[model samples]
Target: MPVGAQLLEGGRIRFRLWAPLAERVEVSLEEPGGTVHLPMEAREAGWYELSTDRARVGDLYRYRIDGVGEFPDPASRYNPLGVHGPSQLLDPGQFVWNDRNWRGRPWEEAVLYELHVGAFTPQGTFAAVRGRLDYLRELGVTAIQLLPVAAFAGAHNWGYDGVLPFAPAASYGHPDELKDLIQTAHHKGLMVLLDLACHYFGPEGNYLHLYAPAFFATDATGLAGRSIDAANPVVREFIIHNALYWLAEFHFDGLRLNAALLQEQAGQPDLLEALAHAVREGPGRERHCHLLLGHDRRAARYIHWHDHSVPRRYEAVWNDTAQQAVQEVLIGAGVAAVDRPLERLGACLSRGITAGGPDSLLPSAFVTFLQDHACIGNRALGERLHQLVSPRPLGAMVATTLLAPMPPALFMGEEFAATQPFLYFCDFNPDLIKKIAINRRKSFAHLPGFRTPKARARIPDPTHPATFARCQLDWNSVNHSPHADWLDFYRRLLAVRHRQITTRLAGMHEEAVQFTLPGEHGLSIRWTLGDDSVLTLLGNYGDLPLAGLQRPEGVVLWAEPGEAEHALNQGQLPPWSVVWLLRAAG
Candidate 1:
């Protein structure tokens, strides 16, 4: 049954809930003087509903289970106070929308920029992000993928700890303000992809256990207390409806499902498949709704298992293998360690996979990035790419990612080389705060630096307010010398990608792309499009210039460290540098 407080005609609000455990459910509306309890009629399939004209928009309400304690609506659209407070009635159709004619871009053209609403700006609201839409548009990103904005317990969090899936986080802004951001982004030719975590619910303010125990399955090993029961029909419907609500109501272009592999159910309809089907058959089908699954290499094969005869199952999956391999080569044994850097990096560039390729999947099905939120935030020490590697190597890695064949995503501050660290932070209560801090320290106990008691004490507490404040991007830093130069470098690289590379790779056979190691520490990649045009990339990872390498005959599009003229004149590529060349004819 459809859940939550649905507004009908003539200022009437229909409150419906699925409470199988309760004999009677009543709607408690907060009035001017006190609270008013309205009796609800029980329906089939363990559902209860009530219609009242007095409960209009802006009214605060909750559910009384079997005349017991009151709790916030599980399907709340707005929580004015916080996740634990009363649910406010909101009419989705009331807000004026301007993105009617905005159809999203193709998957191949996507250059994703991931950000958290709180850390994105000092203001930490959806309204604040609207001021930077033009900046992102000028930066040449086609899409902005935001972390979860659902209502949670306290004032600050990474958004993964959301308890109310339907309600936008009150700390971010008003519900209408979120719509304003999405509409504004669409007008600027930027698509919005909301990050959603449906595998498990957060511990704080989680009211599901109070009403619906069947919603979750017992899994002691799961990250959260328990995993969602994907096999349950009610749970499945709730998940599917939430996906549609975001697309149909908020006008978001797509969704990036976090920990997609965890939602798998055996001998039952897959949640991802049902989601893709719902989007394709729904009213937003014309918008080309892209579904990107965040899965590791172990689940890459499942992405291709869906029938190709149907509409495309997913646009792409986050290429963690490629990210880890590249990070190994650049950072080596720094903050986070990686072994076999050369071999892993070589395999990633050669076959589009670090370990092995799923034969049926297309090259575009994988999304690669030089740095991502998890790679920087979840580390033992939260460090940016600039802190991990020198300028030249960082430049080479950034260039390689942008010019790669697969879609590429960028963390918020990477383009300008912002020095702020993106550490993992949450705003749980004091009781859970100490436990979370201890567990976080234990997570990195294997590392030599974090193994000591004194060293472990230096680690930032996830519940500290200062920790969340430190992650905010410093927009002023872009005005400095190297930061300004790096920003320009990203602009040029993305320009070349959007203009020259993306169109050329369309329909090209896999055999046309080739990768070769120029030296023990350098790589060379060349590919020919169907139009006979050739694109080649050369990089030097060592401290010395790579010599005696065959150079492709074409115009030099870009070079690292402003050394294009020097490298093109002399056949030797400089140390820790990369160059992109294009030939009109093979």
Candidate 2:
């Protein structure tokens, strides 16, 4: 509201730009007759403003600074002509929404499936994703957390390099199409959440540095060494309003905020706190708008160490610590613990896996995922967990993550064993693409495969069209034998989770749970559900069977290899198996 073009009642459009570096600015509105350049009034505190009846909705406009050159609106709602092109005036009130009473589902009931809009299907549009809602609902997914769709430079991106914070990408069809996708998901009882970058802009298509150098702080940790100047009230408001714009205008149920600008923003909490506060006061008041943070570490002070006076605190942090711990267990990396995987997993299940390990936080306060965009894309070959690890250990991981008290999320293709690599690919300017490719290989220089130049060169040129194309999902392969089996496994686990676990998750906390790592690769965890009920998990993630383990006292809920009674009667767990049992309360 403070900046950008706003449509006034009476068919008049009010335009505003905050350019302190320039002495004057003009609004260049494209008309059927010709270009109309309107000189804006210089206002106090580096602001320029104009109100004109000449401009209407669907008009192409740009702001020219001191007659130097015209640039797109920094807060443009829709940039159909792409990021480097002119901005289009879009009135959000035009699209009719059908899900007016969609209050949103609870966080505990969430079975999140994170996806990138472009790579989700071959069509790579909002309408295409909307068509798959029925399939997702049948798969037992309650929410779909989309990767960032904010406008970026080229037609393809993972969306972390988004330059326009407010506009939906032109490549993903119209803004109305995106709204329809969300609305359709809402009516299908599936909540749609968006992932957004907060602290930096992409390397290209950003004209802010030329006019508003003050928009950035002198920090080196940003995506392209350009950290957002969050101390500036204008910059802070821009970030806050972007969050509100998506929730209010687009009608997204929640947001997964990734402040990936810096490695250590733990000490500077002002910007994040203020942004969360603004949301808590705004659209958050109307619905179940959950907020999840993704910091460098398993950061949780933002989620757990805050006062909950007005729901200002985040609902959860992306629990990367537990995921990494599970990875380390799969690879046998961690040293000096009672048991292999259970040693690390116990710390997470007991004390919080936060930066400082806060014991007060509940297991549900974190979102645990075995695979996501960052982990898969950042790898040398962008391999999925199924590609990297064995099926049995991977199944053990799936059982632990989904059946645990914490909420679980899955990558787009993880459910059906889609073997396509979710590689790190982007379309930057020609001058920058080569450098990005080189850096992409160099970042993996520590890996054994990338130890030499030739090997690194074989690391898949991220700038190449083939690299991006290689990452698209193979829809035709799902109904095949192995892929269909994997799909059935995911569907079955999620169905059991929804029917049994999610209902008992409300009152679960660290104090009500216990675990015992019996052998080298054995893990036994129990949660004291309310009403005196108890849920137990017995797992063996080793090649050899684990024997002499006590049989859990409850009815069998789920078991890998489908032999819970056989394993229980034998007083042992089969290799690479997990069994869950529930002891109902008296």
Q: Which candidate is the best by lDDT?
A: 2
Candidate 1 worst ten-residue window by lDDT: 302-311
TM-score of each: 0.94, 0.95
Which candidate achieves the best TM-score against the true structure?
A: 2
- lDDT (10s digit) by residue, model 2, range 1-586: 7779999898889998889898889999999999889999999888899999988899999999989889999899999989999999978889998888999987778889999999889989999999999989999899999999999999899888788889999999999999999999999999999998757688888887778888888634323746688767788788888888999899999998875522345656576677777887888888888888884453566676332222337787787667777777786642222244567676675554734646667766778888899888878788888887888788878877888777889999898889999999988778888888888888878766678999888788888988888998988899997899889999999999988888876655457878788888888888887456899888887889999988889988888877755886689988888888999976
Determine the backbone clash count of candidate 1: 0
lDDT score for residue 177 of model 2 = 96
Candidate 2 contains a number of clashing pairs equal to: 0
RMSD of each: 2.6, 2.7
401, model 2: CA deviation in Å? 1.2
Residue 271 lDDT in candidate 2: 63
Can you list the residue pairs that collide in candidate 2? none
